[model samples]
Target: MSTKKVSIGAKPTNKPATPTADAWVENRTAADAHETMKRLTIDVPESLHRAIKSQCAMRGTKIADEVRELLLQKYGNH
Candidate 1:
């Protein structure tokens, strides 16, 4: 067998180092909506934080749902 020293710049690239935006997310249909959930984040002052937690427990639901309901009530158009 013969030995060969390949050139340093001879390597080939078939793709980009970073993917396009479309590659990051895929299109979804209504069928997928039932299987997926979204998350949101918010910051509250320490004084009223416990009250929010208690309200969530009273509603027998997650803190996220409680917050969403409150915002919808306050800003219905949005």
Candidate 2:
């Protein structure tokens, strides 16, 4: 399986302005507004739950992140 490279806590760079900076800010704000998180609860079999817990423990990630990644991969980003 391929792994994604993520910068867990990278700082944003302070760079010189470009002509499209205003548009970039507007678009990013709009995207952020629409991307708010919501809570979800689901019931799964005990074995499946154990597997999820095991995978998360091995990878040093939470079950929620793993579930979200799997869902986003199986279904198109909505």
Candidate 3:
């Protein structure tokens, strides 16, 4: 049997350092400047939701993004 000592409070050496607070805030500000976003919710059947999720995954897209594009296509001018 082999035993290794570990420190509970020690940070992992292999991981990259996290972004500074200033950098994160700057990035978030830049993103928010492009658009103000709102949330929409609708009830969906379980099977329909699963199918949509599967299709989005296969197409390398997020379900929300796909829904946004669809909405834009249908009613963007109005």
Ranking under TM-score, best-scoring first? 3, 2, 1
Task: Predict model 2's lDDT versus the native.
Answer: 0.78
What lDDT would candidate 3 get against the real structure?
0.79
**Model 2 lDDT, residue 56, Cα:** 91
On residues 18-53, what C-alpha lDDT tens digit does candidate 2 reach at each position?
A: 759656644453233457455568999999999989
lDDT of each: 0.66, 0.78, 0.79
Deviation in Å, model 3, residue 52 alpha carbon? 0.3
Number of clashes in model 1? 0
TM-score result, candidate 1: 0.40
TM-score of candidate 3 versus the correct structure, residues matched by position: 0.55
* Index of the highest-TM-score prediction: 3
Reference-based lDDT, residue 44, model 2: 100
Which 10-residue window of candidate 2 scores lowest in summed lDDT? 25-34
Q: Which window of ten consecutive residues has the lowest lDDT sum in model 1?
A: 28-37
Off by over 4 Å in 3: 1-33
TM-scores of all predicted structures:
0.40, 0.52, 0.55
